[model samples]
Target: MRIAITRRGYITELDGVNKFIFNLAEGLNQLGCEVHIISHALGGSQVSNIASYAEKFFDFQGKFQIHALPFSYTNDALALPLWFLNGSRLINKLEVDAVIINGIVPLNSRKVKIAVNHGIFTGSFLNTNRITQHIYLQFAKHIYLYGIDLTVCVSSKLKEELGKLLNIKSIVIPLPLKLNLYRTEPLGKRSPLVLHVGGRSSKNAEISIQSMKILNEKYDLDVKLIIVGHKNAYLESLSAKYKYMVPKTLEFYFDASSLVVRDLMANAKALILPSRYEAFSYVVLEALASGLPVVVSSAIPSELVKDGFNGFRLLQYDPNLYAKRIKALLTDDDMWDGMSKNALKTARKYSHIKVAKLYLHAIQDIMRMKLNS
Candidate 1:
């Protein structure tokens, strides 16, 4: 079977969506399917030149062919239409059995197309812009109902949201991570350290920081809050007032190629995610694979985390309770050990090979259904 995957983003970026595409493409190839990647050129002053774009393509080493579509406009709304035009032309030239679109975009084609829903627009609680939110919600609904033959959601929470919008249930497929790249290490004794992974604007980061402040004041505990990602001036200013609480360390965004994240996860006392919304978080999964306990918001699906077993779920943004959970995980050795073991066990189910088989099964079913129709 020949499959064509289309994405409207830079392939070299280490974001969750790009990571998903790279891993899925490699997995499909291993399953004996001829795969091709159709991507739009990232047009900025830095990479606007043809030679820069070609270099980016050469950086992506895969068993499949890559076709870069010419797009002059950088705005997604304008670029998407141009992408569809260029992609349609390429599809006519290649005999592909199916096309997998990574996001919601208007594409009128006869081939079987699948739309993967990472998160519904309505699920973003922190976004204050009403007009942009409405536009995104409308687009999601249109793509879910009319633009694609099948839709896949990364988490049950997101699946429920998609079902409500489309009036049809979406297939739930958890995001897969390369577990082999992250090994479970025995960090004998953990310090009073709370690790938060993501950008500053992330709701998860916000909740984690607030919770740490509560924990520090109540217990008078000396803890360090290490945030890995870009620093937001807004968050940084907020952190300044609570100088006596927990010491904050901001590490800017770095390449994922280094095993630094794995090392950090293995050594941390606990991973805390105060995200207001998420389809499925790669950081949480990576932390689990490293045998680290997690304290996440209740908004995240229970299937991905258990309240008392592998991780603690914060029902709402209560800084005091969130702090208490983190403190317990840090001080209580027996409870921490149990959660760590469970975390590793749960993470094994999301291995790359296992996820690859599930994706292949879905594609096969779609093909069979199309043939019968």
Candidate 2:
């Protein structure tokens, strides 16, 4: 079957949502489906320019085609309607068997329409105010989704949350991990590198910095901390603000590519994420795929990080506790090796092609039901 996956943002950037789109497209392509990517820009930039930059990110030379609509916007809230107007025209012309939308957007097409729910931001408890939370939740539940044949949630928690908030039923489908693109390195060959992917407030990046400080000062471990994310002023200032506190070293990577991140994971001792909220974490899966043990907070879903099995899952954002766990993974070779093995095992279950098959099955079932009805 022919399929087209749509996203409002550029797919070249390996953010969580973009990763899901690329991985799913690759998965469907591997399963003998003709796949196409339909995307628009966030800023006021032409689609051709973005597509040129996007070419470097795709490893699959010409397995699928990319369609960038000539639409750009500054405000995401206003972009929805613009996308509905321009995106519908482009998608309708594509004439694919199915179209899977990465986020909420309006489209009036007769073909099978699948809307993916990555998560609803009710606001982060660590950063957002109550009023902001209310407005975000109201917009997500009432305004984001409409005229879609099926809604696919990335996690069970997300499905439950949306069901309760919007009184809508949705199916759960986890994010896909490109296993071939991310390969494992020997545990003994890795450096003492701890990775933190996102720099958002909800990511609890400050906690990771504090924990690194504790790991250096308290444990006297000579490990390096690498923080990678999109360009953000607050995240960029973190290294300078805590320079003295974290006496060892802190490497900040802004606008890093997926290949760069995968290489970092290949040689890192552990991946630390103290997020306050997550619908599902693709970074955690990438770490697991690279055979790197993760030390994430309890706020991350439990099934992803199996405490003492794949990695340690802390209950809170306490720096000392995180320091202790990081130290344990760095110093103890036996524990590290064991966790690394298990991490790879867990990653196999979320392989890109495997998850894509699941998506295809769901799409087929729903299409048949719609036809019958």
Candidate 3:
């Protein structure tokens, strides 16, 4: 079947959502489906000032075609409307079989439009602006829920929220991870290194840093925390103050092509994610696939990680408890080995081939419903 994927997120950066879109398109194409990915002309906030527009646009590669929609203004109000117009025009011109829109696209295309919900912007208990969160929820309702024929959520938690707001059920389809890209090798017992990966603005990073400090002071563990992503001034300041307690490393944003992340995850003893909220984290899946145990917040969906099995899930924002779990995993070799094995097993369930087939089936089901209606 011919399919079109639409996204407003940065294609230039190697963020979770972008990785999902790229991998989905590639997998679908390999399955003998005609796929086209339509993205916005602009990049993300972090790279907007540093990278050129052309540099941002040229970062993605796929088996199918990619169309970039140009916008006159950078503001959300202006950009959203323009993106809708441009995207609708492109869909009409292509005349594809179906369209999958990431986040929300205010387009009135005749083709079946599937809206993918990554997460709830408002319900997030993270350190985010209340006004901005409210505005985002309102926009999701107005643009996303009202504009799509079907909806898909990356996690059951997100699906529940969408069902409540839209008064319609959303299909739960976990994000796909390329398992072949990350393989397990006998890295042996890892060093005193804990890895945290993702954007710096996420409240999870703050929680992770705090947990590290607690672990350092309480257990006197000489562990090093390596945070890989765009560095924030606030995070940098925190790291500087706690430098004596824990050695920290801040790496700049890199694309998916960068091998540095794989090396970091493969060598780390554990991956700690104390996110206040998350739909699904591809990084955690990647770490697990690489034979690294994960420690996540309870707010993260249980399906993503099983506590005391593949990984440990802590109560929301409990830095001391999170630290204790980390210390135990770091200190106990037998426990760490068992958890690492379980993590690899869990990662297999999210294999790229399996996820690709699920997405294809969902799209076909949506199309069948449209036909019957």
Can you give the TM-score per candidate against the true fold?
0.84, 0.89, 0.85
Q: What would the per-residue lDDT of candidate 1 be over residues 9-125, giving only the tens digit for each residue? A: 665444667667766776677778888877765556534453333234222234777777776536777876776677777875787877888866666577778888777653332
- Relative to the unseen true structure, what is the C-alpha lDDT of residue 354 in candidate 2, on a scale of 0 to 100? 85
Cα lDDT, model 2, residue 112: 85
Candidate 1 positional error at 337, Å: 0.9
Which residue pairs show backbone clashes in model 1?
204-274, 204-275
Tens digit per residue, CA lDDT, model 2, 1-118: 9898988666655567876876787789779999888776544453445444554453443367777667654556677777778888877888888889886667767788888988
How many pairs of residues collide in model 1?
Answer: 2
RMSD of each: 4.0, 3.0, 4.1
Candidate 1 residue runs with Cα over 4 Å from true position: 43-64, 122-139, 187-192, 214-217, 231-258
lDDT of 1 at 315: 87
Residue 127 of model 2 has an lDDT of 58
Q: Candidate 2: give the clashing pairs.
A: none
Best candidate (score: lDDT): 2
What C-alpha lDDT do the candidate models reach, one value each? 0.72, 0.79, 0.73
Candidate 3: residue 115 Cα off by (Å): 0.6
Residue 35 lDDT in candidate 3: 84
